[model samples]
Target: MADSVTADPAAPSATRPTGDPLLVLSGVNKHFGSLHVLRDIDLTVHRGEVVVVIGPSGSGKSTLCRTINRLETIDSGTITIDGEPIPAEGRALARLRADVGMVFQSFNLFAHKTVLENVTLGQVKAKKVKPAQARTTAMELLERVGVANQAEKYPAQLSGGQQQRVAIARALAMKPKALLFDEPTSALDPEMINEVLDVMVGLARDGMTMVVVTHEMGFARRAAQRVVFMDAGQVVEEADPETFFTAPRSERARDFLSKILTH
Candidate 1:
């Protein structure tokens, strides 16, 4: 149920010397019945790092994101946040989830709750923050995401873009150490994509550690310190955004870029 795969035994235990990585995945592997979803994945995300994961459909990009937060349990692998291994269940897992926020493509907001209520719920219930303080934090996050004016509105009353921004605000209210985004803008209309991306860019600039699964190369170019390319459940290449876009080392990555970029 748990294991680790290291690139080199001689390498440092953690990714960097300054401090422990914000997130670490060692020899991570997962499967669903007969299908192998992630294979020998070794990745490390440091504090303040913005890592963008890009891959073709069915390549396990979203699975990779989900596993980081234990939404999809790995068959065998170790995931650590802030130097501690993730627990399999119970209060420990809940605490880990609070520390690692996630935003999905569907903008999973509570339709029955107002925008402010949606953002405050998690902080109040899970984080045990006082109701008044939770509301204050929620308002600040909504304003930060540029949707405070819609605080009283329900999810159904907002545009897809506004709803997604509310989702982001909800995640921020948790004050997570890192955020995992599963194609955050994929479901939005073309006109709405930039609004969401702008908030994400601001978060990156503010030094929010993030692992994003997205095909939006423009966002990657502008925001990512590193770009990871995955294919068929394995990471084929990783590099700085400039090099990844201009001269990808792998043929798979080159072909992917060609197809996605041309259109």
Candidate 2:
């Protein structure tokens, strides 16, 4: 059976989570050559809220997540984290990235570095922390994500799930206020997906504001406070999980869910 993501007292919705907006995207548009990838996108993720973005392939879900950390630039619109617009380039952009962590579909670990090294490098280099202090924080995060025992091994020595957990640990080492996940489980083996999802679930329970782009309906339905459906680069619907899963208001969302749930 697949892993379940059911709400409990610790879930965002259960607590009626609301707070200062952490990430805001307004009138966001992006074009790759003649292809319009993102169109008039408007979305917000508040502190301690989990907003899951679900859509079919090529619907701009991944691009939207990437834009939050400025990994992908936009042709128009405004994106702000903690109410400040992202800087074009420089130390400001780097600091902005440090403030918002991102995990991609691929593990993206350094092949040459040990798991511990990978987690601590950013803190030591970017945050100007001492090596010992960085390692301490890295170990805590590694332990938090259930991968501390794998710290001495290089990325290639660990299983895919272990590597991904380490990636999550690396992100958390930055102490980012919000995290973005783009298809976090898409590249995982069937058995490994749950381990990563378990880590994510714990983060949600601990009040980590998150924006996730994924097709994992169970996680979205059970973990997210709101679900946003996108199609052809436009947001088609947004609703609480129960309503979105049972009685989606938009035809596009209904059609999309029908195709997804039937399989």
Candidate 3:
């Protein structure tokens, strides 16, 4: 079945705590020399939840997403995934990264590798899966993302949407417990945005816990269970998608929605 927003958008759905949170952050802070990029951030992502983070440029939305996987380190605060504290480095960090998959705005595929190779490379190298096993898994993921037909093509040969879908497939091949999308559709042409979004929609429907950083309001409304609004390096407000769009409590959130939704 296609992924869908819960019926009755106004109905509240509390953050599910079926067990321990799959991802958690508390008092997270990050600074770039004199610039404070993230300020006292706290977030919890439960299993099977889809949370979309949205805000103006320089609002720290992307930085927030990066910290979850330790792509960017926090100066303070603790982050834990599946009840384990984030490791500082070495094999522990590598294992943590394997459990969390990240897709960047850039497709970041090896220019020389075929789409199939791009998906299988990490599985074979990092996870130490056998080549034949990795190939079968790669083909299954490519089919899942709707790009099995283009498996033999290089990144340069595919459209931006197709390349991003391959990127998603590559991340999924790792069999991560959660996925993070950093503006996955920002680089795509308008016509291609929906194609990438559709693949993401499918992943959400299949119960992949996801945190997406994007300006795609329609996807945010339709797929996200919770909408987080950030401003000036702080989480200004967070609410269910319907309430966030229709009845934002903070003036900053209201102004942001006005500027984006009107245009």
Candidate 4:
């Protein structure tokens, strides 16, 4: 199930100095029986780049993010990460997942474990990091996310913003090369969204390679180097923030922006 589809035969390996791209999706198609969730998805993300994806519901935004980690299988086409083609299952897939950290809308934390323990588990299990070393790393990441004070608290005891920060720290503890956020702020209350966004803004400031699927136009404008607009399982437009927001070229993109910004 490992395959690659490069834009050019002489193209360099994705994620290499050959300038191929950090990630590439070519003619990527996903189907659940007859329902096509993604169609002919062609995209390239380079190192140290942030790309924001936006689309209407069912436009395959979340599905596309999940596909990067093989959380969902593609029925056709290929996806490459750092020049490595994603395998269907087993050790190679596990390694790929480890290299790519994902943050979900729901703060997927262990409610029963302390925040420190939640962050430590993955490092200990997946990375085989020593307990003491893992704890030190976890604390540093927690501090980075501005949640070091909440390390002893359980998810149930923390506010939504705090919980999400902890989740971000946990993801960073894995030292992933790239982070995928599937609507990271979608589940937060209006007042709490900024806190999470602030942490993400800091990450962007540090030049983390990130792909965020969010409708937060403000964050997209402020943080993303490229904004990709998808419609009907296809990318209708791709542009910088200023161009995408002020002068989108596609009719669907303009319409989508009008509706979202109006409200």
Candidate 5:
């Protein structure tokens, strides 16, 4: 069976798209002491778009995702999500985070929490959802990720794939307007990679407004609306998956593609 998400563009919500992008980064720069990790970055993500970012290790892909949620602060420029500029700190930053969910490469579930608890904790504490209400919503998200059967189990009791699914469910419980995935399947065993990718592919098909950083070529080709090729802290090329795979425009992109495909 195919795995894909299907979101209705006409869904009514006060915070829904106004034909403006859900995410925008303009002239963004980030530095770690003397090292320039990201520079003059400008990008935008629309309401229902899936953008896949690919690059060699240490090429700033992960740092870029971090900067979006302010996990790694930008030294210059700005990041705006859902029409609000990302505040530097305190309540505003926390509120912005609640609107943008993130899935890390390592399944970062609380070891002591059950899958259900992991999913509900954020909603209850951050969103002020009542316990009963949070549990119900958590179950719905767990079911959506096909992990309802494991909802009562601790993260340690589940396989890597199961744990990753729970991580995804936890992110979704926040009802985020956009999702950031940082190599979601990179740490999984080879045999378990597909299951997690399947869930992500489903989200993309549904138009969840995602930005994913991964080296999964097949997933990029089949599921992404646009593929961004980055190298050495810069976006070298951006194209639809078809052209990105077959007709890369930049020399850096072409070189990167050759190494990736030849490996």
Candidate 6:
């Protein structure tokens, strides 16, 4: 919901600052037919920490992000958010999703709804907030995202970047505990990419806990407190941004960096 969610709607369940595990994945595994997309994944994302996951395409980074919210279920392993394992199904799972906001590679906005309605719908429908209150919050978010002027327009009428911003505003309307991004900028035109990345950077700076899967090294290097490198469906390296970018300890990481940096 942050265009500049400088003002949080609610505090973390507990302020871990840099240690409390807001999201934990243990021995997480998944498969798509014969393809093992995730393999014994174990990771922890602390409260208010931003972790960026980077890897070549088909490395299962996107699948890993999807598993957090149960959009893609795992064959084995455990994932917990805010100290609670994700609900198996029904209203409980829905409620858990409300707590974990997600932004996708494609701007998954309601194409039929106006930008304002798109942003406010989740708050009113899922959370049962009054329409007026939801609208006020929606407008505030849209304004902060720099798309308030286009609030009345349909998704088709706005540029790709604007639609994505509206999608972010919609996610923020829920005031989730953590946000997951699955290559959010991959679909945008080159010129429109930064507008969305800038919004993400602002969210990180404002203490939003986020787990991002992206190929944008600059964004990862600049915003992430830790960088995770995934390869062949496994986490091969995890390090601070500087260590990852400059003195990578893993040969796999160094090769990956060489390939990425040579471009």
Q: What TM-score does each of the candidates earn?
A: 0.93, 0.93, 0.93, 0.91, 0.91, 0.92
What would the per-residue lDDT of candidate 1 be over residues 30-55, giving only the tens digit for each residue?
99888998998888888998989998
lDDT of 6 by residue, 1-263 (tens): 11111112133421124758899999999999999999998888998899999888888999999999999999999999999999888999999999999999998899789999999999998999999999999999999899999988999999999988988989999999999999999999999999999999999999999999998888987788887888889887777777678877677777788998895
**Residue 232 of model 4, lDDT score:** 74
TM-score of 6: 0.92
Quality of model 6 by C-alpha lDDT: 0.87
Question: What TM-score does candidate 3 get on C-alpha atoms?
Answer: 0.93
| Best of the two (1, 5) by lDDT | 1
RMSD (CA, Å), each prediction: 4.2, 5.7, 5.5, 5.2, 7.3, 7.5
Q: Tell me which of candidates 1 and 4 scores higher on lDDT.
A: 1
lDDT, candidate 2, residue 77? 98
Q: Candidate 3: where is the Cα deviation over 4 Å?
A: 1-19
Clash pairs, model 6 backbone: 1-172
Residue range 15-106, candidate 2, lDDT tens digits: 35578778999999999999999998878788999999898899999999999999999999999999999999899999989999999899
Say which prediction, candidate 1 or candidate 6, comes out ahead on TM-score: 1
Candidate 1 minimal-lDDT segment of 10 residues: 1-10
State each model's CA lDDT, in order.
0.88, 0.88, 0.88, 0.85, 0.85, 0.87
- Window of ten residues with lowest summed lDDT in model 3: 1-10
lDDT tens readout by residue for model 5, 66-98: 889999999889889977899988998998898
lDDT of 4 by residue, 88-198 (tens): 899889978988889999989987899999999999999999999999999999998888998888889998888889999888888998899999999999999999999
